[model samples]
Target: MASPIKVCVTGAAGQIGYSLVYMIGSGAVFGADTPVSLHLLDIPPMMPVLNGVCMEIADCALPCVREVVATDDPSVAFKDIDAAFLVGAMPRKEGMERKDLLAANVKIFKVQGQALDQHAKKSVRVLVVGNPANTNALICSQYAPSIPKENFSAMTRLDQNRAQAQIAARLSVPVSDVKNCIIWGNHSGTQFPDVRHATVAGKSVYDAVNDEAWIRGDFITLVQKRGGAVIAARKLSSAMSAAKAACDHMASWWQGTPEGSYVSMGVFSDGSYGTASGVMFSFPVTIKDGKWSIVQGLPIDDFSKGKLEVTGKELCEERDDALAVCSAAQ
Candidate 1:
């Protein structure tokens, strides 16, 4: 086999980090064909816990895990990494406002971005899994000017999977029957899960269900709010499923889109459907050669027009907010 690819993850001590490290190390991700060397980056206070976790991983003795190193410094940890997974972020406490949240995350991503610019291998590709993921990724991309813009993406595949599950359950069909569903806009409560474009097996989802009323009043709302439902049902955050979704997202990114279809991800917009450039937003996209490109020339109806507009506007507002904070800090 060729040399092992080096993958680095930040926030290696959080709940998501725990699941992510194992799955990636276990050959569930990055394929069984390729061995991986892992560099886990955590905060200084969390390194001891990460060290213990590393010891456990050692016990697992996964042949795919060639080496595991834990570090609190990005420069030391990310050097020569092939891909970077940004899974660690500060969660907002009760009563914290969006601006405050953005301020805090921007500080973290800024340093990480600069470090990536300096130390990460020139070819490193990054995926940000932290909250406010799209905006956090935008900050990192802005700081890491040397990296190509297309290399930055935020995790919204969980939103896509939730849309699939909700649609399948309501339509009484398996998730395999659900196809072409698009998650428009950001990965928040305002997200629009459009079934109008979705297909069940080969039939249009709207026609497959044959009930526009249910699609309107229930499907979109359910998919958009499913995260809250999971938290309510499990009494804990959605980490395991989120980890699975991350695996799916990267899998699809490296693999080509299915024969004639696409998926959605938070990619840097190019003014499509009135979304501004340089800001990342979710759109129907396909991956070719490990790069995601938004599908062009799709027909957008009046319904999609409104849905995309609402989410697209929210992204612009948040982008401006993040930029204003950066200005004030300077």
Candidate 2:
């Protein structure tokens, strides 16, 4: 058998990391067919917590995991990594200044990007899962100039999955029956869940429901606000579901996307679908080999265009913030 692929995850002691380590170690994300070795990295203070999680991995005795190592150093953790999931960021706490938080996370990501460029396997794929993931990913991609732009992505698959679930619930149809659901723009409140591209049971979603008011009012709000809803209901941030989306995002990107179907993923924009260049945003994408490419030839109605621009504008703002902050620092 060839050597196991090395999977590195930052922030491996936190809630999402707690959920993700086991899944990745067991080959749940990549599949049992591919053996994996996990490199779990966390901050210094979280080393004890990571040790506890590592003990659990030992007890589980997952054969797919050739080895599991926990560390505090990004350089050591990312060494020879084949795939990396960057889930670490300075989250918003009470009274934290936005600039300060962005600066802190940028510092972390800059070092990570450098380490990945120096030590990871050639063509290593990166997924940023933390808050403000788009800009953080941009920082990493910029710092790691050697890595291909498409190899670094942010997590918008969460927004996409939520969009699909809400659409299925509205029409009282199975989620698998909802086809070609699209989410455009940022992963925040402004993200647009475009049902214009959706078909339920081979019928257009608008034709099935025929309620313009519902689509504009409740449906859009539900998908846009779903992350906050999950936090409110669970009394904690959405972790497992977020991890699941991360899994799906990479799985679809690494494996081939099915024919005639595409998924939403956040990748560096090259002006595709009229998205602004240098801004990272979610687009309807088809993956082949190991890269995600925007699906071509989809008609964008006026409503969808407005939504896309709204979210796209926010993404450009994030890019501006990064450039401004990094420029000042330089």
Candidate 3:
């Protein structure tokens, strides 16, 4: 057996973390052939809950989990870790402003970024799963100056999965048949769930559906608002699906995406596809050897271009807001 790879999950007591940790422990993220030492972290008040989670993990006796450590200390959770799922963040209250939420999360991620820089492996792969994830990832990368920006990414795979599933259901085809469904820009409502290049069983999605009105109207709107719809139906935010998407993301990042296919990931923008240079933006990406590169040369129609611009603007605004919060604290 390979040496145990150290993995960390923040907010391990939360619903998503509860689902995600079991996946990671069962070798869902890193695979069954490799063993993992799981490090779980949450707030001080959540430690007891975290400990109960650890007990359940031990009771499961997952063969891939060689060890388990539950704690409230970021330093302990992060130390020499190979991968981190940063799922913990301050949830937005009913009356709270967006800027106020950003301010609170910026403080959290900044400290975590510093922890990652000081203690985690140089090659540590960090995925920010918290709300306002793109800007939070940007803040994390900024604070962890010693860690390469490429190592930090926010979860957009959930949005991509939602788009793909919606397309599959509309076409009455298995979800596995949907391919190349692109989720562009922010994970928020401004996100563009583009199927211009998507296909169902090798047929163009446009032709498969043959309804331009639905594709451009209901299809797009539904995918963009799916999270809200989920929350409305369940009276809680998405957890099971979100956990699955997070697993899909890390697994692809670790193992590599299939050839001739791309997935959406919120990575630090290098001005690709006319996006602004320093914000975290989601783009169709292909992975190889644990590295991700933005897919290039997809001709964006005017409509798609406009959608991209709107989401890009929102991300830039968020980046600016997070930076202002940081500056204020200093």
Per-model TM values vs. the true structure = 0.95, 0.94, 0.97
Tens digits of per-residue lDDT, candidate 2, 1-330, equal 668989998998988888888788777677787889899999999999999999998999988888888999988899988899999876655344445656778777878888988888768999998877887888988888888888999888888888788888888989898877887777777888887877888889878878989987898899887777776777667889888888888788778688878898788888877878887788889988887788878898887888888888887887787777777777
lDDT of 1 by residue, 151-180 (tens): 888888898888888778877888988987
Checking candidate 2 for backbone clashes, the offending pairs are: none
Writing each residue's lDDT as its tens digit, candidate 3 over 1-330 gives: 788999999988998999999999888889887999999999999988988998899999899999999999899999999999999987644445557768789989989999999999999999999888899999999999998999999999999999899888888999999999999899888999999999899889989889999989999899987877877777777889988999999999999999899999999899888988899999999999999999999998989889999999999999988988888888
Worst 10 residues of 2 by lDDT: 92-101
RMSD of each predicted structure: 1.7, 1.8, 1.2
Per-candidate count of clashing residue pairs (backbone under 3 Å): 0, 0, 0
Better of 2 and 3 by TM-score: 3
Residue pair clashes in candidate 1: none
**Looking at candidate 2, what is the lDDT of residue 53?**
91
Error of 2 at 212 (Å): 2.2
The 10-residue segment of model 3 with minimum total lDDT is: 91-100
Candidate lDDT values, in order = 0.83, 0.83, 0.91
